[model samples]
Target: MEDGKLTVRAVERALDILLCFTDSSDLSLTEIASRVSLHKSTVHRLLASLEGKGFVIRDASSDKYRLGFRIWELSANMTHSDDPALILLPEMERLRDQLDETISLYVSDGLERVRVQAVQSNQAIRRVAPIGARMPLHVGASSKILVAFAEPEVQQSLLASPAWPAGLDKASFRQQLAEAKSLGFATSVEEREPGAAAVAVPILNRAHRLVAALAVSGPSNRLTLEKMMEHAPVLMEAARRMGKMIK
Candidate 1:
């Protein structure tokens, strides 16, 4: 492939626009310009070119533009296919049943944690979050464990963000992350979502790198903070045992 100089400004604005699509469904020209810190006309021109190239689509009714389905198609093809989801689901189910709570497995995706597998408890009252849900690293027990065990670069990127989006303040998040790493387990009390509490521990490979996080979650009333701490050891052991069995 031949290499040539690309317009840095154009490239930067394009990335800014693309990043805006992560959490937002649709954005107007003004909103995109403000978020990207580019002039309205400049953003409009870029959006027009991107739309022509099938990378961005405009909603006529709302007069807003967003990432096109082309991005989804590309991303779906790029997701991990060799991970332990298939090999670990049954074990996760057993753990969930034994504990009478939800068990989930997550892996680091950049600074975020993505749920790859889950097993819901048979209890009538249980929390159920599906697979493929991406969560903030600072919030839930599973996500925090993933962040605590991540490589230094991954942790640094999350900490360096201007606004931590997991409903956690920077200082509090840092404190929890440090404690979790030292303790080899993570517990959260109503941090990720309302009325939910969880405990999790990292699954490490033979090389001591994090492969996944094993977590149990339930309603805050049923899974009190005290009970979560008590159950931490159980979850930690399960994660370790599964890690050894898996890749």
Candidate 2:
């Protein structure tokens, strides 16, 4: 066979291995080899390549293979009119009208939180997050939710940063993260910007891995912590819907 065809065959086989995990969360080398109908050695080789690219994760304890965060990252990068942003904008618009606030989607990038999408409130005074703007992961409702639900190693790395906000107690912050995870949503009052406040919820894929944080932001007086907590359910439901469509 030609060299190009050989490479194409390798690509197909690798993709097959990745697809096998859709039916099950974790698989062993023999299990994957059987599912893909390839030899164990070939499956192992493909999995190694996938692992190198962060496409798969091998648990040290169970010696099992599972999809990794890289898969979630690529899936979230899709763009089109009415895209991930589109899929959530209608719901966001409804939220904006109801709360008269800015609705946004935030995703973690390294140790930073980035605003990937947003729907602005029509009110003369409203919160806005420009697409691609980077915000401190430890500073706001959406930012905190993104970091709080992140994988443990990621959370540790973020918490250990020297840039942690002055005067904010780490112990109290840990308590807040615990509460947000327990309650399924988080709220902030002028934590990042003066006169600004927001509430956010985690968006998770079928694998239960966090995809992004969905948020509502506005002037602190209008988007009181109480009001945001009250709307938490609706935001959570919206997040649930958005997450279902991911991968």
Judged by TM-score, which candidate is best? 1
Candidate 1: pairs in clash: none
Q: What is the lDDT of residue 80 in candidate 2?
A: 66
| lDDT, candidate 1, 65-161, per-residue tens | 9889778888777646456786778788888878899998888887678888889878888988687778877678887788888878777888887
Question: Residue pairs in steric clash, candidate 2?
Answer: 82-86, 83-86
For residues 1-247, could you state the per-residue lDDT of candidate 2 as single tens digits?
6999999999999998987865578999999999889999889999999999999999989999999989999978866643566666777788778767789988888888878788888888888667767777877888779878999988898789887778878888888898889999999897787999889999998789988899988899988878887889988888887788876
lDDT of each: 0.83, 0.85
Q: What is the lDDT of residue 11 in candidate 1?
A: 76
lDDT of 1 at 174: 81
Candidate 1, poorest ten consecutive residues by summed lDDT: 1-10
TM-score of 2: 0.64
At residue 209, candidate 2 shows an lDDT of 90
